[model samples]
Target: QGRGRRRRRVAPLAVSPPPASERGEEPLLRGIFEIGKRSCDVVLSARRLRWSPIVPESPAGGTGREEIIEMKDVFSVKLKRRRFVGQKKGGTLLGITIFKCLHKEENKLTDCAVHLNNLSEDHCNSWFRHLKEILNGFQNRPKSLKVFVNPSSHKREATHVYYEKVAPLFKLADIKTDIIRIFIDFVFCVGGDGSVSEVAHGLLLKAQIDAGKGTDYIPAPVRASVPLGVIPAGEAKQYCYILSVICFKSLWHIL
Candidate 1:
């Protein structure tokens, strides 16, 4: 071994490991880009809401079926309500017995049959007077009266109950009304506060548009102008607080 110059073995160069984030740099960069894009999208959506002009669709007068289809996709979801009409025939044992007795009396006192031989004349006269008054009230109702019904107000069949049970009472009172769906005009809503707010907004927009068109001479429907009669069908009836006209019993009377 020539010991001219002992060259020490060169140590292998130490390689430094990549940083943790650097190892996953591609995914990290993609996530950041996606977040930025979403933020931009949200900002643009907000701007669109502010700048966009809302226009009412032309009234479709042919049949309501087509209009219902057109509006189906516009709202979030259909809210439903349960309603009962005049008491059912066989709901309870007591109800059944009472109905049976009334039915028996009516059958016996038919036009073809003889009047109750035992009852006094004064009793019959008083009953007939009361019946006449009720009939007169129903016969002389306001022609301008119109009823807006929201069948889907509550989770139950409230609309059905109203149509069957409650509506007849109005008719008996001589009020001429058509049980129209609230959606026909945007001025009616089914839920609570949000629903009423939407109706108010629609009315405001309609008023603005009508004014712009110089057709202010024509009056919008009364439902649009007056305070909406709320049925309080949903979880919250907050709008009722604002209007100061929330009444569970009067909902029947409003119709």
Candidate 2:
């Protein structure tokens, strides 16, 4: 009958459920998370932190995980719960600060931040807890860095400067750059007389240590003097002076 036909159509609609979301107990935290300086739509799900182009990389904001920052790859996350308050400037500000050392892409490491904004407290906190727990699992993560500190430089705090100013950028870039005394190649220097001497002396000291351990550092193919390149950043340049005078040519000038 006519009543039976109405029931069949109604049944199909009921079976469809909510096609968009899967009975979300809470809403998903999805917004733009800045791919470069430009804003893009990012989704924070239970599994992964994913982003897709809102600026139209293809049709209809594309689809699927075109760019994804896996939860496992996330290293350090600093959650910011501050909102710039005032009548002039007021919003429910939530930020998920991600300092990530991403998994290797083409056998290379990448580090970056997933900067997010305009999220509810529930969404932010949920993502925070999830992210924190995942990051905790990586406490025993392996790391490598090569740190060169000029002790007698102008500020006499080159190491401190590296720790403060430079290291944060390295962390953001997902680049490992903070282990001490770890260069086997030509040790390049760019400070005053102390710097040049320190590097040259350090290499010899390292060589001496290696030699004492019965390890021949100067192997068959690699010669005694490895090439060192320096682009000077200071006024007093003893390394460059020595190189130019002796025809060693530490600095390369392009014609």
Candidate 3:
């Protein structure tokens, strides 16, 4: 007893809530789930998902601590379940798993996951359907992307970077990707200046061809149907860095 010391329990930190207008009128669904090893009261709204830890009532009442995740940050949701060894048939329902994009240093975005563990299959399925519908309603999100990787860029590390770091996130988000197909909801490139230039040129060329014109078409080349995104893996990353700054600045203003 003389050498041992008692550990003090720290109060949970409270996070600021989203604006009322952003959350809309009412929650789409409400349920009890285990999050972060704590039993939480979860609420899913049109624009965000919120959760608060459940604690016994004290004389001081609640601490008003809650966590909120904006729907715009969420990329995918999947039903969680448990399957025993060699059990391919229907598994026991666990709950729902949400994959979201988290902002990190140097204008980077990475995947983060939150698991809502509940054993009730019916309850979980209801929440899953609502979450899926909400996600599908985001028309700005692309379902498929055409990827172009320059294996020669940066000592031939571009391919490795794309496969190792980028492809897993895309797969987790349930996005379909094709390297050589013409049909695409978006265009993604991983390389340096040369690769970026080639992809841009090729998109414009394809647009012109789709408009029944050739490469020499001068009267304002048709615009590409999908947008292009770049991942800098080459020596010349200054342009990409600058673009990221501008984009984040705009987002900051919007927020």
Candidate 4:
């Protein structure tokens, strides 16, 4: 067997893509930046820039959407967006401004900007690193969300409301919130508290946790306190009463 042993054949070396550091790839930047009293999560990636408002704690839905800046159409970063400077009060001022003109409608001009009022010096390095990485080329990290739609809740046309209200925002943010047993980010509960409570129980894996326990009732899991939201449908007890009185104003602003 030793005398008949065949010589080892070497495999040809194949080229691989360059390392992120070597390729001069940019790191994606994400953090809060403010405009007046409102604050938003600003994301800077190689291909695009976007900012989404920080939603407040409320059962009331937020209208905050991540607005994207198309790189192909972006001719220039206005002076305010070119360089982030220091503030007299304290901290760094990182700003992002965009002017959009649609391809189909070239004459249209829309301008908007958001500034980081006072980012702490301690956190500046990371932000600057992200900005540098974005300048080079940064890979996008997709977001995971849990979207719940209650079609049978309010009117017969409630599903239409969900498409009009929630889906577009998710699309803009490039988040996929497909149904799954477990969820990563916020759980948008569109119905009442009872269903939300049950969903929380399942998300916490209570059935497995409570298995083999002698107790008839499984106590609520401590980690079941996921961030949940319940929007009032006219069919529900609350918003129906409130909205009916408010003359049923269009809900476009809330979501």
Best by lDDT: 3
lDDT of 1 by residue, 1-255 (tens): 677988889999999987764442221110000121121111111001001112225263121111101111111111112235875442321100000011238444211111111123443344334323333334333544667775544433568878877665444434567667763322235677777677676666554553453334545532233344555566776676656454443364455
Clashes found in each candidate (C-alpha, N, C closer than 3 A): 13, 3, 0, 2
| Each prediction's RMSD to truth | 31.8, 17.1, 20.4, 22.2
Residue-level error in angstroms, candidate 3, position 220? 40
Measured by TM-score, the strongest candidate is: 3
- Candidate 4, residues 1-255, lDDT tens digits: the string is 689889999999999987875442243666676756678767666666666777887466453876776554443232132333653343334453333335545665443333454345445555555544443342344466775654433333456776886566455434677742323344544554455455555656643343423334656434433344445432444533443332233233234
lDDT of 2 by residue, 1-255 (tens): 566565434445445565454442232465555555556677665447777656566666564446766666666776655555554454455666877675578787857666765356776677678666656556466555677775533234556777787788667535577566333444456666566666666555544543343344443322224445454555777665666543245444211
Q: How close is every model to the real structure, measured as TM-score?
A: 0.22, 0.38, 0.59, 0.29
Estimate the lDDT of model 2.
Answer: 0.58
**Model 1 ranges with Cα > 4 A deviation:** 1-123, 130-144, 156-158, 171-174, 184-255
Q: 78 in model 1: Cα distance from truth in Å?
A: 40
- Residue-level lDDT tens digits of model 3 in 14-106: 998877775563788998899988889899988889998877675654423799998889988989879999997789898899999888877
lDDT for 63 in candidate 4 is: 35
Write the number of the candidate with greater TM-score, choosing between 2 and 4. 2
- Poorest stretch of ten by lDDT in candidate 3: 246-255
Q: Name the candidate, 1 or 3, with the larger TM-score value.
A: 3
